[model samples]
Target: MRSKYTSFTLSIALAWGVWGCAPSTGTPHPPAAVAPSVPTSAATPAASPVTSDTEAGREPPPAEGGPLPSAERAGGHEPPPSRFPEQRITLMAVGDIMVHDEQLEAARLPDGSNYDFAPFFNQVAPIFQEADWLIGNLETTLAGAELKYTGYPMFNSPDSLADTLKQLGFTALTTANNHSLDRREAGVLRTIEALDRAGIQHTGTFRDEASRNQPLLLTKDGFTLALIAYTYGTNGIPIPKGKPYLVNLIDPALIKADIARAREAGVDLVAVALHFGNEYQRQPSAAQREIAGLCIQYGADLVLGAHPHVVQPYEWKTVTLESGMSHNGLIAYSLGNFISAQRRDYKDVGVILKLTLHKGENGEASFEEAEWIPTYVHYYRKNGKRQYVIYPVSLTLAAVQQGQKDPALTKEVLNTLHRLEKEMKLHLDSLQKQEKAS
Candidate 1:
């Protein structure tokens, strides 16, 4: 398949206060609250020169000793140092990780315990582990093994899934999806508990008021990012009496309100992870575009979506924040399935989107670049049991290159991506206009 955003460059920079902040679990504990703020040096928005291999789909070279790009100077437009600490952060986001009954059985270990999913996820571990921050969607509930772990109908996954995800460097998980309440209240509570125990942060669903309003804070490379998540509904699950706030639903009012609260909390970057749209359909529905535009109009810095179970085109757009500052943000309408039991043509593959944040010498934050890495979920049928596994495929690798030589698989994957791009091109151009106007 062809590479997306090949012109973008990925780099790691730690600009003074922008370099090393810890990922916060609940409410943010700002640096000033813990220790005295250090005087920071001016930052530069330098990125390494792009190479052919990176554009060809090979992994970008390591950042060590790589030259940093020079900061953009307006000659006289520089502003005063930003009061909020400027940070250069790198984030890696994947799509849905749905655990079906078949894959759960494959996770069965030798001892009496259930499945150990470490091996199945070994392939993409490096990519996740390598990034300063990793994010993805969890489509199944972690309500324990005694509960039947079915696939499509309703899912109650093993809590072990949380442990496996954390060990693989998944810092945050979006609990918002159509299956958020597969087992109703039990499913929601169990999933939260399991993620808590694993030390993995989660959002989109909560057990109480405190959890519901909790802000997911992560410090990577030097930037502090606040992530908020919401889903369309909980499989038609009614909001329990007196607990309407237990789960995040797809209400524009709710989303805008939550975003306002997050920004007030002093979050430098705000990311909204939304789960919407029909399954397996390549293009985003009209409803998807409308809602996404509204989100950008609000205070959202970036929006990542899932629940479509197929790769969707991403657009870099310019949005005005509540602060009245206009800046560019990346939005992936849907990432499809990072790993699942679905076995079909387009449903089998996923994309890995890499994002880098930068700060100029003026100390203002901006999105530097983004790149999409194509990946696939391999299926194996053995011992009369079918299992699903995830694999990260580089776009320009020899195997992928050779696979592209095949007219069938290559044509299908490339065609779907092209269609997605075509649908979003106008939106991207509109975003550029907004940026220029600002």
Candidate 2:
């Protein structure tokens, strides 16, 4: 799964310690170096973790950790402000979150009575409460234990995953994907129910026409984001007869209408997340570009693409509207897989796309800037037990060299990370790739 930039300041990091199956110990390293508008081989820091005492739900604990401390303390007050100031809102989004059979095994305890996914995301805690809002793609189904838990071709994970996602600070997620129908209509309905129980907002697949007709508008710090999601298809799974609302299929006209309606609604921003692209392909196909462009032209401020299972190109460009007005929009073709047992080169690599958005009191908005933090999942065997952890690549390398102080072991880990980081560079900043594709 892909990740986003957390600390442009390059200093925040989550404290590290051992947890049952949660992302376990290491010296807390700063986040990855912030990747600029162009994904160059630069270095910055990443993460802001608050160690949580509680796991999502496998076992009960007192409660999760507290929020990060604010810059201001008690008795502190803001200075006098000028008129009509613009508010800067930071938005964070990650790529596909697919739990394969191996991941299920890793999350399952020795007794196997329950499954816990909190450990999988605990290491990334700094991102938990920092962003104004965060988004992730639930690329599997939480169709309940009554159904056999499986993966890959048909993914039905435990409801506990939603508890962890809620504990991890995900305000919203897009559930419309090829896996939406993995359990058919039951999967689609149960998944949303789980999200609701977790108090998380979701878009894309819907339970009925009224739900499908109503657009999903997420409000944060008074700024609203209209989230519209659709998929290319459901891996040959047929939408139940007379139940088109069960899944959102990619349709240019429908996509345009949705964006138009959101625009008309006066929301601060419109983000269309499309789960379309070839699996394991390092680059987006020509069709991906055309569809992305159409969304931008139709008034979408951002396009969050996924399903490539690898990082694809991203661009910020000026989009001219039919009314002769121009606005900047971002098209991130794919964020890649955020967390999974997919250990193949790029499949194990992903990024967190962090965007800075500015909105003036006058109601004008702008896509101020973009940054990314690369992530690599480390799946291994420890004491004959399978373990998996996601690390911010560059920062982990730095921590090992500076803190671990084990030359031989550090060298071994660094070799693996350095190679992965280099592989990430090849797929980012693809203006040249875009030109060629055109």
Candidate 3:
């Protein structure tokens, strides 16, 4: 298969605040798509380099070879200089993790009883590990092997996928998507069990009402963040009777309530992962813009969206809350497919969205910086065997431009890379024009 490389300018910005939170359970319902008037902009600004003192929450480095100072020195009362404490955390998010039949077959082990997906992610593991928390959309169900492995129309993947994700340093996953109910209630329950076993936190779907009632809370570097996920609908599959809480749906009221709950819980940041958008479309639909604005209005600090199966533009908005307070937030309409079998233009490309967050001495959390690295999924055969790997697009392009050949890359891949690079340049130019006009 051919591939493409693209280039786009990254924006950098100063600090920003967090959002509110709340929780609620509900049945699956389709949200009407409404086109909202909004302007498209480049991705959020790149994160500033975290200073050593801020990152380690420590005072300035002491003089080399010098003894550390103490409160009491030489039998006299000597107080150390006072300094405010600060901490920094980095978060990375990606698009859908879809395991199609081709992927499942590629992962089959020699024993035939299991599959190993670890190899597929090895190339990108270092990038993922660079962030303090790595998050992604789990678009397939790990309902166990008893139900048989399938893909596409309905997905039921082996539990090994979850195991691989956990080993790759994924801190959490958003399980709300069109395929969440492909295996029915049993599938949902088993998926949750598998995630729990892997020690990865998840949101959007739950095995029980009680679990659904609670928010997914994560604490790191003196900052508390709450994540909530919701999907447009469950692909026409009715949620189990009286168990509307099984999968989160796109409902503005419920989402706002969840945000309130997160705030009430004293979370420093609230992020909403929304699985709603037109599939295979490079541009976000009207409904996406509407809901994104609503999310910001309801106190969401960051909105990460998915399900378009293709990367979409990013927008930054300054919203005014009910109390007349203004907040700056970001929205990534669609992250696209992180990994998949689809070969359509843009379908095989995605991005790793990274954000830097800082907590000040006053106990306030804010967004420090935001940026993304484009990625491409490479499918090739090696040693008479099939292999699937993801590569950073920029690196791949650089090697090709240098006339270096990779065994895993093909002529088609080079052509696709060039095409993507051209397209991205045009897209960025368009955004710049729009910004100038605004």
Candidate 4:
């Protein structure tokens, strides 16, 4: 009856690439346990002074109320007066959205038949109102009540969970994770249908070959993003013989081909979601680096990863084009759990990975800024029933200290919040040095 979360942030330029150490889907193994760190991330706080990342060597943004710079031409082109031809959009993403046994019990109606997951996400809604697109990992399957609504090892949840996500402003979600097949092929199909009824966009799992073959593209403000997702495996679940298209497993060749096709389709950006890496680990493994590096090399503009169920470091890698123009791709190895019943320290953590992406009249992608808001899940008994609420870590801590009283803000909870904020700062800061060093 406690709390959980996920998140990442990045600022980088566009380039072609793809990567993730391919985990074969032919086998199914139990997923590793996550190490909780609470909430999500400590992005610049909305309650405090605005914090911006404009490091040395990075160009200062154009003066406000003035014209912006246009895209630079290769050798023979002239410098343009302004960047007026470019369009800007915002993207926000998070880590795993999990349903545990306790949550299932908590959401069950007093009538004992229906479930209402609405109260769990209200606090986090305002923050996402302006995002051009809101994406997250739907870690559990919407396999319906006939599946008995289980959790963890074989997660199946009320279809209304998808409705809750839609109401929460989730424009899209990735479905190819270790637990994607908890109920096997039927679960995957029903999950897709639930999302459909909720009017939510999803990638990763597909019910038909044609759906698998088609690209998942999201367009807004004159820019389009092609998103592809691949999990290492379905916890060793052999993807139902002859239904290879049912779920997206990590296969470099297939990914390469997919990215190639996305590029051919002329999407403004390609974001690859990878559900790999060791659970409970805060750092990405070498194989993770290899996979991410390959994805960036294969032309992915943004690489969002998960499976660690805890926050991990992010990177902005520079890739030079044949014409010598320098561009960097974003690689957030893990965003942590978006929501879960996990009680571990860091595993309880997550962030709302936010980015400001720009597209030129020519359809080139560039990044203006990135941010994350650290969040934590707060669980407590209400009217004799257990409940959970996700709160921004720093903002809530500040309020609690300033006399905002809440029954669940125990000394232990405050202590954990302080530690999460401190650690997250140190963790995210290291990325600056990492990018600079690279």
Best model per TM-score = 3
TM-scores of the models, in the order given: 0.73, 0.79, 0.82, 0.80
| Candidate 1 local lDDT, 234-254, one digit each (tens) | 777786889876788888998
> What residue runs in model 4 are displaced by over 4 Å at the alpha carbon?
1-85, 320-327, 360-363, 401-403, 431-438
- Cα lDDT tens digits, model 2, 20-98, are 0113233222222323332211322222111232321222232357433232334555434545554667788999999
Candidate 4 lDDT by residue in tens digits, 1-438: 002222333323332222211122211111111123222123222211113424322345668976443433233444455544557788899999999999988898999878899887876787778688999999999988888889878999898899898988899999999999999999999999999999999999998888888889999988789999999998877888888999999999989889888878878788999999999888889999899888877767789999998888777655543334444567889999888998775888887777777654444455545666677887788898989878778767767768999787889888988887777866855655664566
RMSD of 3: 8.3
Assess each prediction's global lDDT (C-alpha) against the native.
Answer: 0.66, 0.73, 0.76, 0.76
Descending-TM-score candidate ranking: 3, 4, 2, 1
Q: Provide the global lDDT of candidate 3 against the true structure.
A: 0.76
TM-score, model 2 to reference = 0.79
Give the lowest summed-lDDT range of ten residues in model 1.
Answer: 26-35
* Model 1 lDDT on a 0 to 1 scale: 0.66
lDDT of 2: 0.73
